[model samples]
Target: MNVSTASARVPEGWREVNRAMWDERVPVHVAGSFYDLDGFRTRRDDLRDFEKAEVGDVTGKSLLHLQCHIGTDTLSWIHHGAARVVGLDFSAPAVEAARALAADLGHGPERAAFVTGDVYDAAETVPEPSYDIVYTGLGALCWLPDIRRWAETAASLVKPGGFLYLAEFHPFTEALDDATGTRIVRDYFSRGAQVWDEPGTYADQDAVTVNNRSVEWQHTLGDVVSALAAAGLRIEFLHEHDVSLFPRFDNFEVRDGYHRFPEDHPRIPLIYSLKAAKS
Candidate 1:
């Protein structure tokens, strides 16, 4: 699929827009309860069960976390015994907060390093065939306009036999109307046309501004798998979960740090985690 359109450009203006939005949200998100800095320090693995189970054994391994907003999850890997970690994102404010948090928690510069750049740009900027693990968390994939470039960049970052791990919201869940306060409203198999013009963010409910025009492209589960496979990453495992990390549906309930529709509700996968090895 062609990702370059009138809307999806990597020009100076588009990057500036993304930077401003992220800068505005960084402070709000850091103070918000969703990130929970205290919980991150005390219960490092609490937010990363999917990664912990699928990515397995990172002791003495070098890990690169892409689109690592605020670096909470990246630091979590360090606590889980990763030897070295580098967190990269496009937002200056987010990376600053990540660095501050790492220093405050005593992870220090020796264990973790934060870099600010576009994911594709950082892939080239960071040392190739150096990282033992490449990782990204939820709410990451939708921001990008292309999946093929993302997969290619991911493949280039990891060493031969190293792995890439991603745990993100299922594409099917994106079809549903998050603001309708009702049922699903969007298409599940839409290949063309982009979702545009969205105000406010999923993280904070109170901070709504005019800078809400983000272009998002949707890809099916098959599309993701095929892209990674074509990039020479062998699929290790793909796991679908019934529970989501956030309240996806309006009627869902948050229980035990997970959101779930009622037992009688329609069965739809809310989240999916994948592990692929570069062999």
Candidate 2:
């Protein structure tokens, strides 16, 4: 289901399509090997090394995770000593899964909360913002159509002197095809929605079969940085990496548990981390 244009608002008609697709993916992801719930039961920290390094320690802090699918990373923050944590997702099933995972992990509502709502409504829906850390990780921003509104909401959610941390697939990487990682299959700048209709979710491609359709927007590095700056957030640092946390392409190699390009492939930035503070 293709939308009229890429420049639509956050609660546009196409968002329903994306939401339905994500709702269907929740069950598949929960039972899939990609998440490895068994492994997570023992090895609690699911955050990537870059995320840890970029966001730093969350000990004794209040954290809010936006678009937190299933809450693995949100729970990881709790294990890392966050005093309070809240995870928000548009999909009710994902939120339910997250709450169940928290309970199974022995975390109670006093320590963790999961809310089901559109991220665009987070500023108003989430129990009073002003969290110590507002964290957003990879494979998130593409789902949203409005970066400026997202930046403003993230800034509003952060407490004074606190920061908004983002770790995401770089726009440059998004422009390349996942099969070869060399073909320019997507626009790098803001354009109309990139519509897709595939058979499965990214977590487990063959685990289930459904006509999974979604709409994504392409955003440049400039679009991201400028949005935050416009929202009255001070840019701390923007770091680009050649390695990604996932094997986005067929030729990617696993290094130290992370998926990176093979040595022979041309070096290109695959991911980016940005930290901005509310003044």
TM-scores vs. true structure, each candidate: 0.89, 0.93
Q: Clashes in model 2: which pairs? A: 6-192, 6-193
Of the candidates shown, which would achieve the greatest lDDT relative to the real structure? 2
Q: In candidate 2, what are the lDDT values of residues 23-58, reduced to their tens digit? A: 888899888888887788789989988788888888
Q: Model 2 misses residue 76 by how many Å?
A: 0.3
Q: lDDT score of model 1? A: 0.79
For candidate 1, lDDT tens digit of each residue in 48-107? 566687888889999999999999989888888999899999988999999999998887
Clashing residue pairs for model 1 = none
Model 1, TM vs. native: 0.89
| Model 2 spans with C-alpha error above 4 angstroms | 1-12, 177-179, 183-186
Model 1 misplaced stretches (Cα beyond 4 Å):
1-12, 127-129, 177-184, 191-199, 208-210
